[model samples]
Target: MGERLFLGVDGGQSHTEAVVADERGRIRGRGRGGPANHAEQPGGRERLARAVGESVGAALREAGLATEVSEVEFDAAHCAMTGGADFKEEVIRSIVRARRLSIGHDAPAALAGATGGEPGIVVIAGTGSVAYGENGLDRSAQAGGWGYLLGDEGSGYWIAMEGLRCALRAVDGVGDSTELGTRALRHFDLKDFRELARAVYAGRIDRDRLATFAIEVERAAREGDASARRIIAEAAMWLCRLVIAVAKRLSVESVKVAAVGGAFRSLSLREEFAQRVAQHLPLARVIAPRFDPAVGALLLAYGAAGVDLTEEILSNLEKESGR
Candidate 1:
C-alpha cells in the first residue's frame, strides 16, 4: 500500500498556502495561491475551490503524488481560513477527498503554529489584526479581527489610514508637519491630496491596496518622522490591548506570545509592540513563532488524524521546513 499522506492549508485574505507532509511529520512539499477569503460573496465558492485546488495540486505535484485524477485522497486534511469555516465544508469536499477533514477559523491554526499547540497567544497583523490564545485548560479566547470597516486596530490597514489622515491634516496646516505627505503622494503617484481623496472616494483603491501603504508609513517612521512614529506607537498600543484582553480572558499569569504577519516585519513596530506587551503583561514572554500559519494548519491536520506529534516529528518538521 502507498504511504499515508496528510494535508494542511491556510486560506488567508492575502493568499492561500498548502503543505503536504508524510506520516513521520516531514514536510514533503509546499504551494501557494491567491487569496481565499469571503466564501459567501459572488463567485466566492468558486474562488475558494480554485485557490485550494491550485495550492494543493501544486503541493501534490511537488510531492510526486499527483496523478491524472482531479481529486487526491488524503489520510487527513485540515484547512484554516480567515473567515469562519461554516460555509466552506461543502466547497472543500468537492475539491479534495480526505478520510478525516477539519475546517475552522485561521486563529487556532496560527496559535497552534506559534505555540506548537501548547498554551499561548498569537497576534496576527496583516491586512487585518487579531489576537488568539489558549490556556491549556481546553479554553481559548480571541480579540480584534473586526475587519477594516469596523476595528482592525494596529493592523496594516489602520496604520496606512492613520498615515494618510496625518498627511491630509498636515497638508491642511491643521496638524504636525511630517514627511508622510510627500511619501503618500509619491507612493500613490498622485499630484496632490485632491487626487488622492478622489481616487479613494471613487473606490479606485481597495482595503488591501491601501493597506500596503503601511510600508511607506513604516519607512517614514524609521526615518524619524514624528507623526509616523506616533502612529506606530498608537498602533502598538492597540495591538498590545489585544494581547492583554486575551490574557485576561484566559486568566493566565504567564504565557508565550508570538507576533505574526507582514506588519510585524517592521523592526521598529515589532520593538514597540514587544515593549508595550511587556509593560502590560510582564509575565508574558514575546517570542518568535516556531512556524508560520501554514505549518500551524499542518499541525492541526496531524491532530485530526489522531497522530502523535512527538519530539522526533517536530524536530524533523523543523529541520525540513527550516522553521
Candidate 2:
C-alpha cells in the first residue's frame, strides 16, 4: 500500500522530456534534456543513458521522492525514442539497460497521447516527418521517416530544404524571385549562394540548424510570399497524403488523426494541414494533440505498469495542462 510512481520519457531529436506521475496519473515531477536521437549523435548509448538518468533524476527530485525508493514502488517507466528500424532495438535496449524501464518508439507514445490511449493515427512533423497508424489491435504501419537524405517528406527539414532550393533558384534566375533569397543570405551571414553552398557542402551546417529556415518560410507565407506559400502548400499536401495513406493501410476510415511536432505549432501550417486533410479524406478527423508527447509517454508508462488510467486521472492530466 505504499505510494507508487510511474515515469515516461520522450526521447526526441530536438529535445528529451520526462514526466513522473503517481499511480492515479497525477503528474508529480518532470525533466528535460537535449537531443536524444541516438541515431544522429555519436556515442549514442552513452548519451541516452545520461539523458535518461538526468531527466528521471530531476523528476524524482521534483516529486520529493527519496533516492532509496524501492524498485517495487517504481511501478514502470516508458521511453519513446526516435530513429530508424535499424536503431530501434539498440535504442530500446540502451534505454532498458540505463533506466530499467519498459520502452517503446516515440510514435506509439505520441499516438496514445493523441487519442487518449485509443487507437488512431498520428503524423509527427518535427525535425522529421512520419505517419503511424494503430488499429484496435497492436498492429501499426508507418509511412516516411526514412531520414533526412532518403525521405521524411513534409517535415521541418524538408520544408527548410525546399525553401533553400527556392532561394537558390531565385538567385540563379531559374524560378520566381523571393525575399527568401535575401533572408537566407542574411540569416546565415552569407554574401551569396556560393558562400551558403560552400558552408552547406562543407558540413558546417547541421540538419536541425538548416531546419531553422522553416520559421522564415512560415513567416513569408503569412506575409503573402508566393514562393513560401507554395512551399507550405506542398508540405501540407505531402503530410495529408501520408495521413490518407496510413488511414487506407489501417482500413480505419474516419479514425482520429493527431498532429504532433514543432512545425505544427505554426498556426498557418496547422490550419492548412487540417484543411488539406479534410479536403482529401473527408471522413478523417484531424486534431491537435490532446497533450504533449511527453505526457503521452507517461500514459504509456502507466499502461506498462498495469495501471488503468481512470477518468479522474485524465481530468488531472488536463488540469495540469491548463486545458
The Cα local distance difference test for each model comes to 0.89, 0.81
Pairs of residues at least 3 apart in sequence or in different chains that clash in candidate 1: none
Global lDDT for candidate 2?
Answer: 0.81
**How much is the lDDT of residue 59 in candidate 2?**
72
| Global fold similarity of model 1 (TM-score) | 0.97
Residue-level lDDT tens digits of model 2 in 187-286: 7888888888889988998788898889988988899899999999888888888888888888888789999998886777899999988888888898
Which candidate has the top score in lDDT? 1
Reference-based TM-score of each model = 0.97, 0.91
lDDT of 1: 0.89
Q: Model 2 reaches what TM-score against the true structure?
A: 0.91
lDDT (C-alpha) at residue 282 in model 1: 92
Tell me the tens digit of each residue's lDDT in model 1 across 223-296.
Answer: 99999999999999999999999999999868999999888987889999999888899998998999888889
